[model samples]
Target: MRAKRCVYVVTAVLPLFLLGPARPAPAADEPFPAGRDRFSSPAADERFPAGRDRSWPLPGRPAVLRPWAPPPTPHARGHRGVDLAAPPHSPVLAVASGRVSFAGRVAGRGVVSVDLSGTGVPPLRTTYEPVRASVREGDEVTAGRPLGTLEPTVSHCPTTCLHWGLRRGRTYLDPLTLLPPWLLHPGSPVLLPVLGVPLPPPA
Candidate 1:
């Protein structure tokens, strides 16, 4: 009888040990890693308009003159910008509100770079070149403000086009995806004031 009672006690204790403690359910307000905010605001489309006559620089006419040409090869492997299908000397504009960080040539790329900060959005980095820049470093710019005229030089591309590219920190992003919706259309023409003097290249 004592053996039977000991076996029953062991069986009850064994089940309790096996059960263990109950885990607390996850809280409703708990944040998940996958849902972390990556951008301050929603990402803009790639073909966002900068100003009048200027559209998102992408494959297709007016903006990106050569739809299929690859980016110019400066070195063997440094990919920096996109080729817009615009006519030579076509007006190019700033895509976001920021200060001009750089506005000159870097390794023959007609380099015009803008640092988009304090625009109620994340900082934007863009580069365009082989064109004449209107604004300089420290110049404050609004979205769609004219930065320069796309220079008519066949030196960079076989056909005339603006090489437009964007970055955030060190990550390269497709300019067309961040462009405004209206500029995405092939027929929309964005017109705005030409703010600075045109700095044409040497004759």
Candidate 2:
């Protein structure tokens, strides 16, 4: 009888001893935040739009000629920006309201960068290349303002297109994040199932 009681007590307390105290249940109204392993979620999509009512550099939601494919290293081979399918001489518009940081030629191709302030450290700068400038450096431009005309002088694509790039400091980010109707948002989480137990049914 003593042996049986000791074994029972050990079985009951061993799990608690190993696992420690239980965590409090999350609040009913509180949002379950996305974890650091958000990329592991099966339902999580790859791309997400950045802002609401953001205009495209080219009209009519132009298809991407070349998508953003960041390289392993800065100097390695990669397409840092998306090449939007646009006709030659097509008007390139500003995607957001910001001051024109640069509007000039680089390596024989015209380039324009808008200094969008208050975004992050180094500020967010939107870039368009192979465009003949209509805006100049230090110009205050509104969203959808005409920045330049798309030129094929430096076209990377076999066909004419606009190379749209977004940079915060030295890092390049997907420019499409500026488009509205976000595909992903923080603070929304889907519960993952436990390894050995059945998942709870939807409420």
Candidate 3:
């Protein structure tokens, strides 16, 4: 009787031990090691200096300025921007992420200017004309996003291109240096070479 009771208890307890709670394996998409938080960084603010990337606004070769061309007339002052010779109606992309600060005409120049307002640095200003603007003031924009179409009627140049300008306050810096290395050919003698003119040393 005693041996039979012990055998029965062992059989009953063995099944209960074997039938422990089932734990499902974690799914493949679940992050390992349990809890983690993403998206912790502060939201991007373009106007601040820490937020902006000061690289060239567009990709590809920048339009070359003519060496012998007379400087802007006294009435017009100095050239405030560099002309990029592109075909008419070429898509114009934003240099960095920012808000559209200004978009309108400038007298006879038929100029249109877009001011980008974020990314910790000073606001970026791009000016062009005779082209339709796709963005309005306060609209947030990202780098390389299409801002508008380039129109050739404003400059009257043989080619339709963009006029890109970079500014830090009132001072103007050479826009070429701000471009990425791939856009420039290393070991090339100069950044921009004018026919018959001596080139300045690379900056």
Q: Please name the candidate that would achieve the greatest lDDT relative to the true structure.
A: 2
- Please report the TM-score between candidate 1 and the true structure: 0.53
User: Could you tell me which 10 consecutive residues in candidate 3 have the lowest summed lDDT?
Assistant: 37-46
Error of 1 at 108 (Å): 3.8
Q: Could you tell me the lDDT of residue 25 within candidate 3?
A: 29
Candidate 2, 27-86: lDDT as tens digits: 232122333211111122233324553578987678776666544443445555777888
lDDT of each: 0.57, 0.68, 0.49
Provide the lDDT at 194 for model 3: 24
Off by over 4 Å in 2: 1-53, 73-75, 182-203
Ranking by lDDT: 2, 1, 3
Off by over 4 Å in 3: 1-62, 65-77, 108-124, 154-156, 186-203
lDDT of 1 at 42: 23
Select the stronger candidate by lDDT from 1 and 2: 2
Work out candidate 1's RMSD over C-alphas. Answer: 25.1
Give the per-residue lDDT digits (tens) of candidate 1, residues 27-109. Answer: 22212223222221124323333444333432233444322211223122233445666777777877667788888877665
